[model samples]
Target chain A: MEVDKGKGEAEETRKVAEADRDTVTLKSSDGKLFEVSKEAAARLSTVLAGMIAGGSIDDNGTDLKQIGSEALENVVDYCNKHANSIPSAALISSSISFNTAPFKEPEEWERKFVDRLSHDALFDLVEAANFLGMERLLDVTCHKISEMMKGKSPDQIREVFNIKNDYTKEELEEIRQELAWAFYDD
Target chain B: MGRHSRRASPLDVDDLLAEILLCLPTLPTSLPCASLVCARWRRLVTDPIFLRRFRACHWEPVGVFHTIFQSGREHLSFSFISDPPPGSILHDRFSVPARCQDAGGGDDVYTWNVRGCRHGRVLLINMPCYDRKVHQFLVWNPLACE
Candidate 1:
C-alpha cells in the first residue's frame, strides 16, 4: 500500500509539470481549439503573458470566451508566423521593451498577411489584437485599414465603414466650405 | 458596403475606430474627410485627447509653411508657401496671405508680418511700429485652421 501511494504522488507531480508545456491550447467561444507556442503568445500579448505568469494557463484548453473561432485561429496563426519570422535573438531582447523604439513599417509579408484578410476578418483581428494587448499587431492591422482609406472621399469612407451621414446638407456644405483645401483632390 | 454589413459592430467601438483612423498617413487630407463621416466620428476626431495622440504618432511635420514678404501696392503682403515632404516626387506649391479681419488696416495698424517660425507656430510681428520695430506679435497656428 505504501509503494502504491508513492507512485501515485510521483505521477501527480509529472502531470502538474506537463502544464508548463511549450505549447498552450486555447479554446474559442465556439468550442474550437488552437495550439499556439506558449513562449510566443506570452511575449506578444500582455493578457496572455499575465495568464501564463499567473499560472492560470490550462493544460487542456484555456477558455477565451470573448474570441470567436475565426478570430482565435487568426490570433494563433499570427503568433506562429511571428515566432517563425522574428529572429529569436530579437524576441528575447525585445521581450520587456515598450513603445520607446521608433515605429517600424510592417514587413512585406506582414502587409500581405493583412491584405489577404477580408474586411470583416480585418475588423475581427483588430478587436482581438486590442483585447490581447498586442500593440504590434494592432499597429499592423491599423496601418492596413488606413491604406484602404487612402485617397477616399468622405462619401466613400461613410459607405465603406457603414456610417451614416449625420450632417444636414447645409451643415455639410458649411463644413466643406470651412475646410475647402482638405476636401479638394490633389 | 453590401457584403460587409454585420462587420460594423466591431468598429463601433470608438476607441478602436480612433486607433485605426489615427494610423492615417497625413492629417491634412484624410482626417478632415474622416471627420465628416458622422457626428460621433467628427467628435472623436476633433477630441483633444485623440488629436494629441495623433500628433504624438506623427511628430514629423508633413510639410513646412514659409513666409515671403512681398511689397504689394498698399499693404506689406506676407505670402505663406507650403514646402512638400522631403524626397517628394510632386512639387506643388501654393501660397495664401495672412488675413486678420479684426486688425485695422493702416500704416500704424496692419494685419501681420511674418517674423519667424518655431515648433509649428508662425511668429508674426504685429504692426504699430515703435522705433522702427514692431512692439506686439501674434503667435498664430496655421494648421489650427484645418
Candidate 2:
C-alpha cells in the first residue's frame, strides 16, 4: 500500500509537470511570461512561427519582440480561457432561438463583452487574433473597427480618426459637391 | 566606417502605414492625420495607391426600369433598353430576363417599327406626343395578351 501510494504521488507530479510545463513561453518586448499550450501557441504569427520552428525559443520561452508585454499577457489569458470553450464552428452552426420577441435588445452580454474594449486595445487584439489565426475573433475586431466609420459625414469621419484635411479646401469642396448626390439618398 | 549601407528612410515607414490604412472599407473615419504632419507624410497619403484603394471600394448597382405610359383606357405601354452590368456584379447567379432585347437607334431604324425582333413577346409602345387620343394598337405582341 505504501509503495502504491508513493507511485501514485509520483505519477500525479509527472502529470502536473506535463500540463504546466507544456507551454509556449512568449517573451514580450518587456520580458513577460505569456505561457500558452502547443495548440494555442500554434495560432501565433509568422514571425513567431519561425522562432518556434527554429527552436530559438530557449528552454525558458519564445521572445515576441513586436508585441508589448502587457498586450502579450492579455492575449495568452484570452487564449487559455477560450481554449476551454467549444470551437467557433460548432458555436455558430448551433441553432439559437428566443421567444416571440417583439422588442429587440441592442446587444447581449456576449456581444457587450467584446464591445467593452478601447480602440487601441481592439487593434492589438486584432493583431493578436490574426497572429493566432482566430478567424471569428479577427472578424469581430475588424467589424467593430469598421462600425466606427459607418454612416458618418466625411467631416465627422475625419474628425473621429484625427485625419488631417490633406486635400486643399477647393479640392475638398469639389469632392463634396461631386458625391453630394450619393450622400443625400444613402 | 567608410561606406554606409543605407537603411530605409522615414518615407518608407509612412508609405507602408498609408497602404495598411487604405485596405479598410469606407468609413466615416479619416486617417493620415499623424502622417500628414510632415511633407513626407503628405506625400504618402497622396500616393496614387491610396487614391486607387478608395476608388475600388464602392460601385453603382445596375438599374432596370420600364417607364409606363397611360393609354386612353385601362391599357398601358412602356419602353426600355438593357444596358450591360457596369463592369461589376456580373456573376453566374444572374440570369437573363425571359425576353431578349432587340437593338434600335441604328442609322435608319424607324422608331415606330418593330423592325428585326424575332422572339420579342412584348413590344414597347410609344403614344404620339400632344395627341389627346392614345394609339389604339399598343398590344402588337399576341404572346403578351395570351
Candidate 3:
C-alpha cells in the first residue's frame, strides 16, 4: 500500500523547492499531512481541480475535513499511481465520447492497489473517492466491492457488509417465495 | 481476525450503496438476494430509478416463459414451459397453482386459460364460473414457484 514511498517523497521535496511547485499538500481531518502531484490531483479529482483553479488551495495544507487521514492517504496514493501508470492504446481507443460510456476495467496495478486494503479501508476509499469527485476511483472501488458479491447469497452478503437482516420472518418468506427461481438455480 | 471482521462503518447511504450493488454482474439473481438483506436495500432494489439504471446496465433478458394449458381428467392444469436462453431447449417447466379456489360458485367447474402473457407474468382467464358471468382474471408469475 505504501506505493513508491522513497520516490514519491523525493518528488514532493523537489516540487517544494521549485518556484512554482507541481505538488499540493492535503491535510486530513485528523491533521496528518499528505502530498500528491498537483497535475494528477487536478486531472483525477474535479473538486481538487476547481480548488486549484480558484486559488482556494492553502499552501500550509489544503484542509479536507470531510475525509479521514487513512482515506486521504489512500486517495493520494491512488492519484500518484494513476499519474505514473500509462493507459493502453486499446483502452484509449475504446473510450467513447458519450457521457456515460461503459467504464474500462481497472488496470492490474489498480486492482492490486485496492486488493491490499481491508474491507473497511476499501469502503473508506470509496467514500473518499466520491467526496473528491474521483469518478474512476469510485468505479474501480465499486467494481471491486461488487466482485465480492457475485456468487454470495443474501446471508453471505449480509455478513460481508455487516448488514442486519431487518426483514420480519414473514416478509423474508414472502421475498424468498418471490425469488424462488434464483435460489433453485444455486 | 478475519479480513471482513473489522467493525467498518457501514456504507448505509442509499444512493452510494445502490451504486455499488448496481455493479453486480448477475442482476436477476443478485438484486433479489440483496433486497432481502434489509428494508433500505429492498427499497433501493425495488425503486423505479434504481431498476431503470439496473436494467440499463444489465440489458439482456435471462429467459423466456411460455404458458401451456392442458385438460386433465379432474381439472384444467395451467403449466409454464421455460425455454431459458431463448433458443435453447425446454429445460424446466412447472404448473401455476390455482390462485382462487372459489372462482366457480357451487358445483360449477372452473378452468383457467391463458389470456395474455408479458414481463414474466401470465394473465389467466377463468371460465364457466356460475357465480359471476364475467371471466375472472388472475396474474400468475410461474417462476416465483420454482
Best candidate (score: TM-score): 1
Candidate 3 wrongly placed segments (more than 4 Å): A1-19, A87-100, B1-10, B59-146
Winner on lDDT between 2 and 3 is 3
DockQ per candidate, 2 decimals: 0.38, 0.05, 0.31
DockQ winner: 1
Supply the DockQ value of model 1: 0.38
- Quantify all predictions' global Cα lDDT against the true fold: 0.73, 0.45, 0.72
True contacts kept of each: 0.57, 0.01, 0.61
Better of 1 and 2 by lDDT: 1
Q: Model 2, A44: alpha-carbon shift in Å?
A: 5.4
- Which candidate leads the pack in lDDT? 1
Residue A100 of model 3 has an lDDT of: 46
lDDT of 3 by residue, B62-115 (tens): 544444434522332433222223321123344653323554444535556677
Identify the CAPRI category of the predicted complex in candidate 1.
acceptable
For candidate 1, write residues A57-82 as lDDT tens digits. 88779999989999889999998998
